[model samples]
Target: MDDSIKPNEDIGACIPRLRRYARALLGVRGEADDLVQDTLERAWRKLHLWRRDTELRPWLFSIMHNIFIDQRRRAPEETVSLDEHALEFPVAPAQERMMEMVDLESALRMLPAEQREVILLVGLEQLAYKDVAVALGIPVGTVMSRLSRGRERLRELMEGRQRVVALKVVK
Candidate 1:
């Protein structure tokens, strides 16, 4: 097998996992797909920075995580009115959600982005804690704490326990 082909194959195999994570994290098909495209482009351009000794999957995810963080920090770019360009927008999926999954998705949406990333990485991707740390560029302890907090919050949301905050009154 040619060495070039092997590397391409490896990267190709990871696309599905990246798409799944992106979709879960972003909750929109178009945005998720765009993120995946950006990730692959970045990975290909920075392939030299990747160490041969380390696993490629985690490194690819790290690149993706960094890109996502950078995008979050920047102000939104020029907006296109979807209503005016309905032909440009893709049709939404026709699948109907079960009640439980809808609730779960809504609950996931409510989570802080940090907690949501950690939970989806660990729970949905089934990545090891160490790999998650590497992917997110955080320590293992941080990943564990985020995952723990996220899971607890998810359970609370699923159980319909709304968190109440007591507002201070100054008059």
Candidate 2:
């Protein structure tokens, strides 16, 4: 098999996951698709820069992460507000579980961008800590710290200790 073809195949396998992560990051199907498309384009263009010894999955993720950051910097207004749209989920067998899922989704959205990124990359995408570090261009220790804090904040939000308030009440 040609060595060049292997990377393309590997990247193809990661597309679904990349799209999932993008959707979670951007919170819109169209925006996520655009991010995925840009990521793939950049990855293909920079294929020669990839090291054979390094894992391809993390590299692709790194590309997507950088692209997301760049897009955010370029167009801050493009961010979608989670409160503007209702989160739709498939019918669940139990109402309690569905409510919990809804709460979790809301909590996830409330997290800070850094914490959210770490949580999504490590928890949702199932990337290793070191791989997440590389993808985010941060230290592994920072990744661990962010993940810990993010999980704690998520727990607090879900437990209703830190309620998501739209407006403050005043006397």
Candidate 3:
């Protein structure tokens, strides 16, 4: 067995999870793919910096997180302009499941980026609290707080109670 190739194999094993996180973060297929490609490129270039004793998955996630933050900083005003026609496609046969997914996606999009990232890392990606904190470079307390808020907001959004403004009595 070539010891030199072991790290590469380990990194390869993480690509699917990386892609999933990228897709969830970016919410667009092409953009997610681009982010993953950039992440891989960056990781390959910095492979020497990675310590053998450290876990690879969280390190890869941290790289992806930094890249994502950098990209967002570079284009703070960038928005995806979707075509209305593109969204008029037919629904899937499992309409209830599809609707639930749509609702979840909508709620996710509604979350603040920090909260969204924490929630996705903890909830969707199943990352541990400490790993999430390392990936985001935040304290564990902050992760807990953000995850709590994110879950609450998601629940509110899913339940159609996102609006918090109180109604005034009419004369």
Candidate 4:
């Protein structure tokens, strides 16, 4: 047994963020949970090596992040379903709002990995810029750039839909 992992210690603190980041990165709830489980298992196995002074949540997140990247490289053409329970926003009372949310999810799925990670980390997870920089092992400027580019891409997709709707309205 690894000295670093205390059997009763709660590693659960990191699970929600891990699941959220994984879902955003993989664009599928089921696969994301599987990835999170893999991360926890690996973390548990290698627990003895973990530095006591370091924060465990970020360590787990970094592990999950690397796993997501590696999986993408190994499986280039995989299509993840975004309909998982975690990714599903509440059922909106208004149908139009629900459709818009669906469109937003679709746009998120279309983003490149770098852009998606940045947006998920900074925008969704609300991590500090410094923390995200450290976790991503990238400069803070890169995070800003990816978030900007991702938001622009999302805007373009949404605007394209709006334009089509407007055209139909005029006709």
The reply for model 4, stretches above 4 Å from the true place, is 1-10, 78-89
Across residues 1-171, which tens digit of lDDT does each residue of candidate 4 receive? 557665336567677778877876776767778999999998888777667676666567667777778888898886655464356545899998988987887788888878888888888888887777766778999988888999999899988888998999995
TM-score of each: 0.79, 0.84, 0.84, 0.82
What is the full ranking by TM-score, best candidate first? 3, 2, 4, 1
What 10-residue stretch in candidate 1 is worst by lDDT? 162-171
Top-lDDT candidate index: 2
Better of 1 and 4 by TM-score: 4
Model 2 lDDT per residue over 1-171, tens place: 355658888889999999898878766677778999999999999999998788888898899889888877888764556643654446889998887777777677788878999999989989999999999999999999999999999998987733444324332
What TM-score does model 3 achieve against the real structure?
Answer: 0.84
Error of 4 at 19 (Å): 1.6
State model 3's lDDT: 0.83
Kindly provide the TM-score of model 4 when superposed on the true structure, using C-alpha atoms.
Answer: 0.82
Instruction: Decide which is better by lDDT, 3 or 4.
Output: 3
